[model samples]
Target: MSTEVAQNTLSSLLEAVQPPNGGRNIHDPATGELVARAPEHGTEELDAAVAAARAAQAAWAARSHGERSEFLNRAADAIEASAEALAELLSREQGKPLNGPNARFEVGACASWLRATAALDLQPEVLVDDATSHAELHYRPLGVIGAIGPWNWPMMISVWQLAPSLRMGNTVVMKPSEYTPLSVLALAAVINTELPDGVLTVVSGGREVGERLAAHPGIDKVMFTGSTATGKAIIRSSADTVKRLTLELGGNDAGIVLEDADPRAIAEDLFWGAFINTGQTCAALKRLYVPESIYDEVCDALVEVARLMPMGNGLDENNVLGPLQNKAQFDIVARLVDEARAAGARVLIGGNPVDDQPGYFYPTTLVADIANDNSLVVEEQFGPALPIIRYSTLDDAIAMANGLDVGLGASVWSSDPAQARQVAARIQAGSVWINKHGAIDPRVPFGGTKQSGYGLEFGVDGLKALGAPQVIS
Candidate 1:
């Protein structure tokens, strides 16, 4: 669609929409002021959206795979067509670098996921047979799926839930975090036109709305991506209905630099892995355990490289680090740094928030001499803060790396491939990159263990999360 036509369509779609309880203000992180207002959907609107989804479920499920595929393709096309506007809005609201590869990749990946899911045929079918009787397995949609997505990758994660569920014939009622709702809302406006009116609904509200949706008896499955504490509450809320769930919670992911690893090369990877998106990513490397042999060298390299990267508004292409999305994040990052310094950890680089910026902006911080028990070492900072803990032996390093309760992702750096792979295998994370960090593919299943929450988000395992296997004789 042309830009003018798309803008007109979006404006019309949003006309009657006033912000969930009445209207809510959206802030531009760079200015820390209200830039837009989103209409809040009240109980009545929430009920209607859910009912509409439930009402459309059967017909959507009954559509031939080919028919469903076409709709998904259309949605993908619409998303790609609106990528520029969506990316700008996303960067402004979510506080991520707009020109960086991450933002563009996120937009493109949304389209790719839609197309990929469209091609998948997740349907009921016979699986086994016997002499006297025949057995069959069937895959069926789970009525209405309630997805509570995080602000970090709002549009991408929204599509992650919507694509698979819709492909498997389930209707979705998605709730994006209030901090970054604009991107997903814009996305909804684009794709909603291509599908049945109620097949995909975006509910804009805060914790109350999310709590209502999670505990609501009508929702069949609840897929949430956020903090571990919230995930626990969601799990408890859904217990009564035994709602199927896929929770991708927080991670205190670790990066281990082996004695043989090149300090310069590994330091660059570590900086981007931990500092990208201001270190807000769940799978971002937050803790580093390095061999004492190269501890000083690695720390020095990180400091030198980090100083060269600019920090400013995400819209500025030169800015490698952006502000924290909101006040809560800003506070958390500040407290973590302060506490770490008090605990005797040496601040090797940036450690304080930039005072001149309107938004919550923290400097890229690296602290050495961190103890495992310190808050910065144990907790998921979710900011541009890196804590380095030194170890003398490989065994000690592995033990320290696996000490955290989170097991979402980790990275092991080494020049020896065999040694690195061995170390990678021992780490308790779902994904371990030998020489890289935060490397992900749609074909690979991504998730966590322990407190990081359960169930996979992508790959073939992701398909299983959307539907159920049935056996017939």
Candidate 2:
């Protein structure tokens, strides 16, 4: 379809969405342009969507896995075909770089996830094969899933929620975060066109809509990806209905660079680790612990790479990093960094919003010599500023790393892979990497520990999270 026609189609879908919390303008954070107006839908609309999903779910569930896989494959094909348009929409709405690996990576991930989920098959397992008795384990679909997605990687994260639910034969009524709902609505339209009505629905909204979805009796499961505070609220709201929940909450991930690590060799990876997607990622390396022996060297190396990386509006293809996804996030980054600086932290590279920029464009920042109690070191900044903490002993570093209540992901960098792996085992996180941080695969299970979240979201284990186990004899 022509760009104008495609845009009109997206506009029609946005108009049709029933935002319950009333209406709000969706702006491109990178350019501060009004892109779309979204309604924060309320309980009535949520109920209607859930009921429709309930009606359509059984038929969807009854379809053979192969048949359902076909639908998912078709949706994947559609996404891949529209990768550019979707990436543009994502960049405009979510504020990630359109050309550089930001928006395109997320859009491509959606298509990849659908295709990967379709490729998976959950076969029945035979537990007993005696002469006279036989037992087999079967995976049965949940009727409907209520998905509440976050804004950091809107399109990709929704796919993380929806693809598995669809593969396991469940319908979904999803609410994208209020700040960036346009691309999600557009994505839902693409998927819904290939599948049966009500199989997947996107209703963009804020807190009220999320609460309604979590509490709705018709929703068999609620899979949420956002803050820990919100996840706790979802648990409380869903308790009365006994709804199944899978929450991917906030994370204050820590990365430890070993004393023996080559500062120059890991500099680029380290830069991307902390600032990928402008550091809005839940599993982004928010805190870095380095031995005092090489602390300044590591800082200098990171600055050299980060200073050279392109930072600008997402519409500019050459820019690698765009603005924070929203103003609140940008402010959070600013406040945390400012607080750290006031507390005697040294800014090695940057700690300011781009001057004269209309967007929420905070520069990639690195702070050093911050105390342990500094909020920039303690809390999940979820933005572009990263605090580098120096530790004289590895024991002290491990203690500080494992001391946090939020444990989503952690990484250990060392030239000796064995030592790194051993150290990684001590980090209290759902996933730990020997050298890389936040690198995930569709075949590997990914989630968080402590209050980060409960339940997993990828791999065979994740697919099974959307279904119930039945044994027949």
Candidate 3:
């Protein structure tokens, strides 16, 4: 489609579009009460959105990198100005504590990413030259990027994809998870005001919308974050177009505590890593392998920490532990807990759902004596459930940690700096933390390996993912 035609198509699409079919009625998973109704987008809407994006892509790509960056910076400013309202909406929709440091941290990261992308030099430029010839290379935008973001960290992940693509001069058509579509829409509102009409658009719905978006002929690339199963399906569907893809899929990340580590420190990190967001994080430390020398000590300390975590509505200042985002997540947590108990594992701390709660709420649970083969240890429970596995040898622990199909993120804890560094190097995950877990910076690239999917999502590497290298001689 011609650039003018595409622009008109996109304008018409946005003007006539209504929020997805599932109009507001979204509930606060924490309180089981109506939080807001989410707008749903169906296949037809998704098609129109993609058409609009494709139409705008060429014109967007024609702009100078500096021009695109300016737009990104403005969008960042808009997001920061609306941080409070966005945080509240996020908490209500996704069940994270609205007032928690994590919520604020997300807002800061969003703005930081936008500003960072703006400052980056992503245009084609010159390289070393010989006497006979001159060599030059330029970064070119990938047209019509299709970003399918997850519910857990909705706005942040969307920005992770959107910022780099937009800065690199690609128009984006995003499909936010139906579970947390409002926050994404709020973000889109900010972008729409700060950017060209078709620069960024959000289409919200269930599987059909995602499927349509992934397979849309106009989309040149697809970036998805969700379960490994869904990632595989997206890959399969994109085969026809051979679209460039970046998939940040499921992860059953492990935290290894060496015998030389301090049990107290390891326990603290483990608590926050595993239980934060009620363990809805994909990179959260789901399986922990503690050296036999510190196993009991670590377990005891973890139990104590888990007990102190306050569970209630996410909007409440005192509530550290919030409800699962939906009933499906609640059921998954409950099933994992039950399965662990039946398989001879002991609950070292909180287990089972909290009574007298309307929403989907699961307790911060620590399960001990969980075998590697057990469901809790092997599968991606994706809940507030942590299973502690004991290891007598460092080699055994490392082997066990890397045994899974997932290679997303891992953490190694040791008092000895050398030991921690060495162990971190050996882990198979894409990002490794030494004595820390779930720590992310916009300046650092993040993603996974193996079934966790491929490609980086932040930093210079992430921005490069949205562009192609063109050589001129």
Clash counts for all predictions:
12, 7, 11
lDDT of 3 by residue, 32-135 (tens): 77765667668888888888887888888898878888788777777776676677777888888865445666767788888987886554567867788888
- Candidate 1 lDDT by residue in tens digits, 165-185: 888889999988988777788
What is each predicted model's overall lDDT from 0 to 1?
Answer: 0.84, 0.87, 0.83
Give every collision pair in model 2. 19-39, 19-40, 19-41, 20-40, 20-41, 20-42, 21-40
**Candidate that scores best on lDDT:** 2
Off by over 4 Å in 2: 1-23, 131-133
Order the numbered candidates by lDDT, best leading. Answer: 2, 1, 3
At residue 296, candidate 1 shows an lDDT of 94
TM-score of each: 0.94, 0.95, 0.93
Worst 10 residues of 2 by lDDT: 1-10
Write one digit per residue (lDDT tens) for candidate 2, span 1-473.
22221233434545544354547788888778887677666778888888889899989999998999988888887777667777877888888897655998988889889999888867899999999999999889988999998899999999999999998999999999888888888888877768898898877667788888888888889999999999999999999999999999999999999999999999999888889999999999999999999999999999999889898888887899989887788889999999998989999988976678789989989999988789998889999899999999999999999988999999999999999989998889999987788998898999999999999989899989999989999
